[model samples]
Target: MSSIKEKLSKPFASLVAKRIEKWARNPEKTQQKVFRNLINSATDTSFGKDHNFKKISTYEEFKSNVPIRDYEDLRPYVERVVNGEDNVLWKGKPLYFAKTSGTTSGAKYIPITKESMPTHVKAARNAILMYIHETGNTQFVDGKMIFLQGSPILEENNGIKLGRLSGIVAHYVPKYLQKNRMPSFETNCIEDWETKVEAIIDETLREDMTIISGIPSWVQMYFEKLIERTDKKVGEIFKNFSLFIFGGVNYEPYRAKFENLIGRKVDSIELYPASEGFFAFQDKQDEKGMLLQLKSGIFYEFVEADKFYDENPERITIKDVKLEVNYVMIISSTAGLWAYNIGDTVQFTSLKPYRVIVSGRIKHFISAFGEHVIGKEVEQAFNEATENTSITVNEFTVAPQINPNNGLPYHEWFIEFENLPENEAKFIKDLDNSLQQQNSYYYDLIAGKVLQPLKLTKIKKDGFQNYMKSIGKLGGQNKIPRLSNDRKIADKLYELQLTK
Candidate 1:
């Protein structure tokens, strides 16, 4: 059964790919028009009876007239609908809510309508297609694909149904092909989150996986578990795996360790996925890769990062955004979110059709210490430091911790070292210097005493895995906090580091 599905999926995906390729040729215009049409249709269906639906003539009109909404603003509407209220957001009855765990926020219940289900599946398929194109590996159509996703079961009035997204995809995937898959779901669904992860690790270890996909931090943790579970190394267990598809977090910090674990130079595919929608994916051919996507289904807006929410925020349509300028992204998707700030920052890498790189999150910036350090900035600093010092970091986390004695703040770095050269102090100095040069706020904090000098703490090899274990978040979908804005978590982590 799975073999038959694999054979069919190839041609079906190929047909989708050809259409996508044609659309990518003139994506900016194509996407803009498609966005407009979807918005118009949805608006017509939503308000057509009460009053005539207003047609937006220009991008400016769409940007200025349509009020921007955040997730919090939609909470009331979402909650009402979830509790059985009829609403415009749900064209048909909503099947279920896709519960997602956030960084600072505990959990978010995103309303998932029947219409939105296709977008999730399409996005997953797009991710696979992007992976194939980048690596020039056509075998993926024939090979088993693994999606390291959240659990597939949902708690409901009539017991737990399939997770809104995961369950739907699982149901639709050709059963013959199902045997080639692994999920963090299964019987572990009823277990405590901690025990569930251990069960997931146990199950994932049994597969002879060809492709592995998940959040990078979580994937790394799984590898650590594999090390503990068996005498075989990660390279031995995943010897058949050819590609690693990662999203949801930056992978630069763990790239070296991941490569070492895999035992070969494995290709990586990056994706931009959120509860709202899977917005963009890396192009297969480019070095950094181009971001291509379903332009017609979603409208995109960009506001300059520095100018976000200004008195007159300078806004650009997908067509107008320039290469290399970091901008906060806004999306008007089929989910009935209009002019919504998705909390992600992106920069265009090419303009012929429009390709982009996910820089970081708007909320992920470090500004409490006055260092306006974004993810890209940190990535640059890390790369420069790594190149200069020749020290490879397995995993790292940065946070601002208030000093208990002085009530002052300081930037703390928790790093897992693979090999520290004899001149460790010199290496730390060089890395610090590189950060100061790359980030002015970091320089100010060090020089003007806004914060204490940067401090580095080395952990035992695979220290991050142990940290995750100690927190009872050892595997599956959980991730180590990469950057902490609050002091409570940071302080606790600091104490953990001290004891280590």
Candidate 2:
């Protein structure tokens, strides 16, 4: 039966691939349609009327009327919806509120309208379908798949279901995969992530688990658990497991460690999903970035990352985006988030197909002395330094040491090493040099004596895990920042550092 179903999926995948390629090639026209549709759909809503959505016919008009807003900015309209008001942002009350933990605000409730929810399910499905079409390897469809995520259980608030985005997505998995998916509903519903993972191990331990998807850190724990039980690499246990899907954080820093855990390199898909909307996904195995979903209900606007805080900085659409330029992605979507700043910074790697690599977060970076070092640069630098070497990284983060005890202030890297480097001094030098090469400001800072070479503090094994546990964020979607402007994370990490 699985074989028959697998055969059917290929043709369906091909059709979807062709459809995706159609919009991908006509990016400008595609976005314009989404833009018009969004404006038309919400023109009757409170936000639309207040923002002059009826009079907005052109991008310039829309841009002029709507100011870019973050979660807090949209909270007024969202609060109305949360309090059971209908048509507050969208056409009517949303189907769900993707409840996410906010930095300042206690909990952020991003509305998931009936019109917007399908896109989340479709984008994830399409990501895998496109993979099948491009790779011509759909055999994994016959095997059990697992997406390590939050509980499928949801809470009701004012007639709307509310939960983490992953949890919300869990309820929508296709019926065909009900039998093919791993970790039974009971196990998945376990609230404690550590306990849930253990339950998953007990359930999936001798099963044909062929597809494993999750955040890398949490998945690492699962892999470690499996290894502990059987003393075997993940690949050896799940002989047919091929596809690894992940999002939320870059996978490069964890690549070496994963390779060690799995015993071999396997194919993986990267997705750009948020509580706001499902944005992009890896459509090709060889591509440098995920293909931006232009034809999706979300209309995208890009603001130059460095100029994001400037007085009325230009917000350009997809047509104006250039290669390698870091952009803060803005969206007016069916989810009724108008000019919403998703906070992710991305760099376009391919213009023709609109492929983008998530570079960093807008609020996440190190600019202590004006050397604005980003997450991508640091990850690249570390990956470059450790490439083909024995030093495997478990987890890592960067922050500025503004007032060091010694010579000069420098960037401090907190890394949990799976295997310590053979020559620690050279590793540090290579890592610092690579960062300098990637970010010109960092290079100038070193040359101008503004900052010393970056310093590395080796964290004890499972130190990052312990830190997360201490904060009650040990698992499920909580990612360590790659770089921070402040020492909040650095100070905490220092407390977890291995004694020299």
Candidate 3:
């Protein structure tokens, strides 16, 4: 059965590849069609009437009438929908609301209309399918695949279900593939991440797992539990495991740790998905970036990252994007998000294929003293620092330490160790040196004495986890902020340090 499924996946994935290629070849036309379809689908709704969606035929016209908005801007319509108002945002009330963390707001309830489910869920499946098509590694479909997901049980918000995006996606896993899914339904619904992982360990211990997917940090925790229970390397426990899929966070810092934990090298794929929509995925092994999902029920725009905080930043469409320019991503998707700033920054790596590398979040940066440092640069520094040393960071976050009262400002890193480097000072030095090499602005700040060198703050074992648990956020789809310009998270970590 596995061999037969493998053979069938090749042809099906080939068709998806062809469609994606065709869409990439003429993005402008494809985007226009997507826009038209969206307009037609929502024309009778209240938002459509207010925006005069019926008369909008061209991109310029659409832009002229519809203003750019973020989550706050759309909250009114979402609130109306939450009150059981139909045809408020889209044609009808959303099927589900994907609950995600908001930067300033407590939590954002992003509408997940039936129309938008394909973009969020099917695009993920297509990512794997395309990977298989490119690599001819159909054997990945031969055995059980473990997806560490949020609990599927949802909370009712008015008439709509509200839950994590992963939980919503899990509900749509094809029936044909259910047999190959790991961690029984009861284990998956455990609510607490630690307890769920423990149940998963017992349930999947002897299963023929071939693929595993989750956020890198949580997956590492799961791997540690597996190793503790079995006293065997992950490679030994799941000999057939071949592919590892990860998203929702940067994977570079965790790469060394994962390679060590698994006890062997294996294929890994990166995806860029948000509650709003699935944006991009790694399409080739040799590629340095992910292919943009241009035709996946979303129209994308980019604003120069440096100017994104400005009152009226320039919005550049797909046609105007330049290679290597860091831009904050804006999307108008079937999820009823119009020119919404998703708070993510990306740089185009290939214009021909429309591939982009996610640089960092708009809110996740250290820019004190005019030295703008994004997550990608920080991850690169960590990767470079650990390359020649035995240091393997299990978890880490950085924040700007402005006005330490006696000295210049510097980046303060809070890190938990899986393996400590022999020369800890050398590790810190290497990290600082690598950052200077990767980001010229940061280097200039150091050279000009505008900022002091970076400082490392060691976090004890499970410090991050304990903090999250204390705040009642120690569960699926939640992550510690990696970088911050403000002292909110830094102060909390310091408080946690006092307790430790």
Candidate 4:
């Protein structure tokens, strides 16, 4: 760790930590200020003007003025912005278009305005700052930090640059940290994720890598590779690597596997970031949920998850939220996303400072027999089933087997195990029991004989990785859905000969 940079990080992190406290203590006031600012900034823009933003003074008025919109609903304005139109969504043309692959929508281009870009960067920076403030760990700042992300290389659409959000974030790394960052620019530009990861290992295998940040699944691939090449745990390869920062998907499913790969426990910080806006981050080491970011130029609105598909589901702001209720998170941000549904659901773990855990995605659930099993429920079941066992899961996904050969239909789990458990039947029984307990609807269905218990299909080691590679989504922000409503991914996984 560098002497000068390490010294500077603590004070700066402390300042950001204090600032977070102020906004967190006054969440309602902070959100209101953000709401007003966003509305005012976009008032002159095409979308704002269309929605009567100038006249929308309160949440009720704003709600009535602009209805909730997904990417398709907001595509018209985004299209105008893409074609080099000024004042289309935000005050001016977006600084960049964060392009993401969508399931039904195809490619989605989320705007990143000049005013909103800093918020993304600051939120990420503050996540670390918050970690440092809470743990007094500044030793990580001086060593090399690497974020396994998409190619930093970008393309131009009209006058605006377009690329993956992580790639875009790559371009904005602090100047001071430039020398401390790893995976040379040339290496990062490698389009193939596997190749990029190899190059990254070649460059960083012996460095004092202190802060390793990436999606847990992808990072797992990297760690697995390091172990293969060096025959040592990742912690041994990079002795100073202390902080593990992750986002995109919940880390619980991979927690045991990661700890096994690392050979020791390491502190981790979870972030709730998306192309639309940087929403929240783990603010305290001991906290269960990330501190919801209210002062980041984004006003949050949440609709009850059960009522999300209703014709007129109620959208409540931060002040009306309650603990442990799943909500489809909505936002009106400075980036010109008005009442936008980001598709992820959240549950508040703390109401005092408004902390939230990303519960699951709205569309990523299985309701084959009215069980309505969500990602969180399945994960909880998996964790509970494997709690004290030597078995560690590498990756897993769930789908309904509606047409089993000769029996009642059942939920099928495709799992890649790091270490297979003894007494396979017992493991399946425990998993089924845990899942039934976690979800009452699922329990009812099981007891009623409407559906059989969940069946676990063990896949070959690295099967998930192979499946991702086959689908051209090996890494770089792409995550396998924990559970799905349909058999699209399930069919593919089955076809790949990944099953044991």
Candidate 5:
């Protein structure tokens, strides 16, 4: 009976893959179908009678009619549904709520519906497949897969319930397949972050793991713990590990340090995952990324950042979406969310359906001193500065501060250098010049006599991790805020900035 069920499900999975591949190549058409399906599903689940949300009928209509609803708008709806209101936007009882620490806002509890589970699983699967295909490891299924995920126990109703998403997925993953897996959530160490790290370390040491998955910072911290616990180098222990799959945060900042620790150039796969939906994954091993499965039970919408607030907002259909254009992602899923603005920015690399990249977040931009700097701009500046200078920065953070002497604002950069140069002044000037050339607003602010001069501070090794730990958010989804815009937050970050 079990074998029969497996056989029946196998064909559906294959069909999903084929359709995804096709939709990836022609996203516009797939999006149209997805949108129609979303409206139908949402109507069926919420209203009980089929009704057209006029604003969302066409891509342009969706943009014009449905206002971009942020986390705040959805919070009330989530609360209502959780309180046992029938005929809510979401049909089923939320399996779990994924907890994400908000940057400007406080903590966010995103509802995870059963219909949304397939999206996460498929995206993860696609990412793994892409890594294997890229590395020519077709027999990846033969080895044990290790996942460093969140705690699986949720404190609820004066007792403990299995963690919603993590616990639910743990329950569903096939027993035969899961028998060969090692997960951080499977252990009894669920109370403290340190305990979890120690448990993960102990498990990794015991297993002959091939593929390792987690956020880069935590993984690096774990490697550091391993080094401290034993005389064995990270490279030696991770030598047998073939693939390193990472997501949730930027890895570019810590690239070189991570490579040095691993001993060899590590093969990595990036994923764009969230509680709302798994969204996209790196599909082809060689190419940067491919949109894996946008049509798998969820409908996607993109609003032009410039016109998101317009009276008649303009929305880009999957066909209308262009390459290299940054768009705010809106999703309508089986979870009953309608034109939900997720606050994420994405750029398409190709016209084909699945050729898109998760650029960054809308709110992550830094205009601390009115320079309007963003993650891509900062990354470009770092690349340009490093190209001409001898200093190699492993990780960095930029905070805008008021110069007490001049009563003007200036950018204070905290950088971890790989090799220190004798002429520190010259290196700082080069880096400043790179930023000035790359960012027009920054250049004008610095050279055009708008703000105080740019300052560079050299930080000690593992300084960022230590600083992040100080905030009680050391591992997992926590990251060094690339740009500090808030005055109070910037003040705190300014104090953490290391000099010399």
Candidate 6:
């Protein structure tokens, strides 16, 4: 660690420690304060005035005034802001628009305002600092940290600079740490995942890296590339590498793979960051959930996930939330998003400290024949089915195949394997039985002859990676939707594999 960084770490960690202490004392109280701040900050803006923000003194009043909305519902204000209008959403024009892909909708440009910086950027910093403070592991900060990020080259939409959220965050990397950051600016702007990763391998192969962070899949790809280039394990390549920060996908399925690749057990932290806001982070080593952000320039609400699809869904505040209930998340943030449905569903694992486990997206699921299956359930099924097998699924996606031969519809899984089981048929059958065990609705459908047994389609090696690369949707902040009700993702994979 540099002398300057060593001097700075203690104080920074102390500050985060204090903040975490305050957050733990009374999350509900802190959230109400956050709600008030958000309302006051935007009261004079167009959206605020339209929603009568100034009159909303309490959470109940705020909920009463602002109805639930999605990106499309706020398009008019966003369009005005894009045309360089001031105070349409936030108090002034956004610093940038964080572009991200939507499941059913196309690309969305979320406004990133000055007020959102603390929540989006600072909260991320706090997650790291708090972890270091709690664990007393400051050695990782003493050395380099390789954050595999997206292209830094942003596109200009009217007067608004637009690009991936990771790129925007990269622009804000603390100057002190920039000296140890990996992948040169040129490599980061290369625009192709495969080529950029190769560039990254060349630049970071010999760096004294101790901390690494990014989407798990992309980082895995980088590790594979590094091993291919150096012909050495990751532990040997960067002997000091000790911390990994991951988000954008569940890390459970990839945990064993990552540990084996590193050839060592490294500390890991999970983050729940969206273009909308940074919501949670793994605060304790043994905790099963990430601590929810209560005072991060965002007011949050939760609607029961099953009820969210209804015409009139029930929106509940943090104070009224119960543990173990799957709820779709809603947020009113500093970026001018009011009662916006972020599409994520989370279950509160710990209410006293306000920790949650993300279940799935409101739109990302398979329910083609009344057999609703979510990302969490799908992940659990995979974990269960492959528990004692040699099968290691690297990446997978499921889509419904309706009437393949003028017969009943069934879910078709497209999977890429790192290790294929000796008996593929038994593996498939086990997977089918597991899903049925997890979701009784799926089981009933099969028994009632409404849907056939699940089908497995083994994808060629690196097929998911190739598909992601082909669509320009590879790397940071991008994830393949695992369970789509329709065949959009599945059809693309089929076409890509057919051509190959």
Reference-based TM-score, model 3:
0.96
Q: How much lDDT does each candidate structure score?
A: 0.66, 0.90, 0.87, 0.90, 0.66, 0.85
Q: Which residue runs of candidate 4 sit more than 4 Å off their true CA positions?
A: none
Clashes of 4: 0
- TM-score per candidate: 0.85, 0.98, 0.96, 0.98, 0.86, 0.94
**lDDT of candidate model 2 versus the reference:** 0.90
Compared with the true structure, what per-residue lDDT tens digits does model 1 show for residues 372-476? 777777666666667644467767767666654664577667777776646766666766787788777789888887776666766666567667777666655
* Candidate no. 1 TM-score: 0.85
lDDT of 6 at 138: 78
lDDT of 4 by residue, 216-268 (tens): 99999999999999999998888888999999998988898999899889999
User: Which portions of model 6 miss their true places by more than 4 Å?
Assistant: 1-4, 7-11, 102-106, 155-159, 498-500
Model 6, range 206-320, lDDT digits (tens) per residue? 8898988999999999998898888888988999998999998998878767877888899999999988989999888898899998888888899998788788788888888
Model 3 ranges with Cα > 4 A deviation: 498-500
The sequence of per-residue lDDT tens digits that candidate 2 reaches over residues 1-500 is 45888889899999999999898888899999999999999999999999999899999999899999999899989999999998889998999999988877898999999999999999999999999999999889988999898888999988999998888998898999989987888888888878998899998889988899999999999999999999999999999989999998889888888989999999999998889988999988887999998877999999999999999999999889999999999998999999999999999999989999999999998898988788999999998999989988888898888877789899988888889999999999999999888888999989999889988887888888888887778787888888899988777877765644
> What is the alpha-carbon lDDT for the whole of candidate 6?
0.85
lDDT of 2 at 334: 93
Poorest lDDT segment (10 consecutive residues) of candidate 6:
1-10
Clash count for each candidate, listed in order shown: 5, 0, 0, 0, 6, 1
